[model samples]
Target: MKGSALTFVLGAQEKTCYYIFADKPNSNVGYYFAVQSGGSFDIDYTIKAPDGSIIVNEAKQRQGDWVFIAEKVGEYEFCFANGMSTFAEKVVDFEIKLDDDFKAELPKAPDQPIAVEGMQHSVDRIEAKLNDLIKSLQYYKTRNNRNQSTVKSTERRIFQFSLFDVLLMAGMAGLQIAVVQLFFKDSRKQLV
Candidate 1:
């Protein structure tokens, strides 16, 4: 069976992020996360077991990946925390993958000894290659998201700087005109 995957946007002022999922004891679970946008592009994250034990704690990280084995049979919680941020919100992308090791039962083919073994091997190799390709694509997607965040931040800074420059220029112009008028007034009084 295929695992479940989801992408969601976390809003501002969230102190904790939680995902509840059930896992059998000894099952392998994998999690990956990236902060696509927000203040500083970083946050704290934690993973808790059903009994409230901390499985993983990461401080001020922009992205991370983890793999762990479930030690008990129950619900587990995966969380991201943005408690340090007062004004800026965050956008998070994450995936939780389960490797249940379930093998599918296929119909038995006619006994063509050589062909059967070769075909199965070929299929397995192709599947492995496809998984690798999928992982690389995910990496690229995360990189692209980070680049977008950087661009937005730079744009905001540039706009603010431009506004400040305009205001300063206008103030300088006003001061120059006032100084010139003062000089003319003094000169006219002296000539009179």
Candidate 2:
């Protein structure tokens, strides 16, 4: 549940709107939009995530100058252009709606969009694996106090020092780095 959504609106009136980031921990998602002057109006504009930063940034324009996406979790920056060299467009409105993935507090969308059936399959896998993981952890936690030291010592060699731990750490770090890089490189190409 990346809980990330991007939405925005157009306005002629000079104004701003603040959008809240999703609740997911460390998820990098945002909204970006722009407004142009003159009749060259575009309402369905998108916000781009800034390169090498979690915050979104302003973009180039063809019609006139306008706003940027709300990059931060709190106050998102915005601007308005009426195309005319006059007072700020008095009759303009902004409509920005962000996704509410924060509600689930889960990881971003899983590998392959999990359909309803896929979710059931994932739940089943977790149920099977979680029980084993919990039981193994519990056994080790109590073995030191309830059983002989020899058994505990052997458990450490098999479970704690197993190839699984080393490989898992390497994989986790590799994944984290990959995700971080995915956002920083060539972001505008995707947003534009």
Candidate 3:
């Protein structure tokens, strides 16, 4: 199994597309993506097979994980669209994986005894478990990033609101003082 992972910023109203080559037919292809920050943490995505057939299409998705068998040997297209956002950009993380099911036989010396098949099975099992662990870790990382962004955004909004409230109160107090002073001045002149 081989894979590539990437993080990118997607601008508002922008569409980005990528391609991955499938060298062998019936290969297992995996696609995963998460929106780490910005806007509503959502985007549209589409996956097209080598023959231009749509394998997956979703709108306003925060994250996705998909696996499918590639039946044709060619380039597969993956696209992310942020047209729903008019001003805010988004941070996204994605991974593309290609897993070849064919296992190559290891060359062994004739004089040496053949390795036990059970040992090989154990190694394979361990590898699979490790892969699952990696995937779980990635998911947790994405969630953490998103939560941090949300916290920062909320903090900023709270500060702005507080500042505005203070300013408004100060302005009202100044206005009231001016009105009282003006009333006293008019009364003094009328008394004279």
lDDT of each: 0.78, 0.42, 0.90
Q: In the order shown, what is each candidate's alpha-carbon RMSD? A: 2.5, 30.3, 2.8
Candidate 1 Cα errors over 4 Å, as ranges: 12-23, 105-110
- Give lDDT tens digits, candidate 2, residues 1-192: 222222333345433444444333334333223232223333222233323233333233322223233334443323433334233222222334344333322344655555655766777788669956944554454333334445555788898677888999999999999998887776867877
Predicted structure 2: clash tally: 8
Question: Any residue pairs clashing in model 3, and if so which?
Answer: none
Q: What is the lDDT of candidate 3?
A: 0.90
Work out the TM-score per prediction: 0.83, 0.26, 0.86
Best by TM-score: 3
Report lDDT (Cα) of residue 186, candidate 3: 95
Write the residue-wise lDDT of candidate 3 on 1-192 in tens digits.
778899999999999998899999999999889998889899999999988999989999999888999889999999999999999999999999988786654455556535645556677888889978977987898899888988999999999999999999999999999999999999999999
Residue-level lDDT tens digits of model 1 in 142-182: 78988898898899999999999999999999999999999
- Pick by TM-score: 2 or 3, better one: 3
Clashing pairs in 2: 1-107, 3-101, 23-102, 32-46, 32-47, 37-83, 38-83, 70-76
Candidate numbers, best TM-score first, in rank order: 3, 1, 2
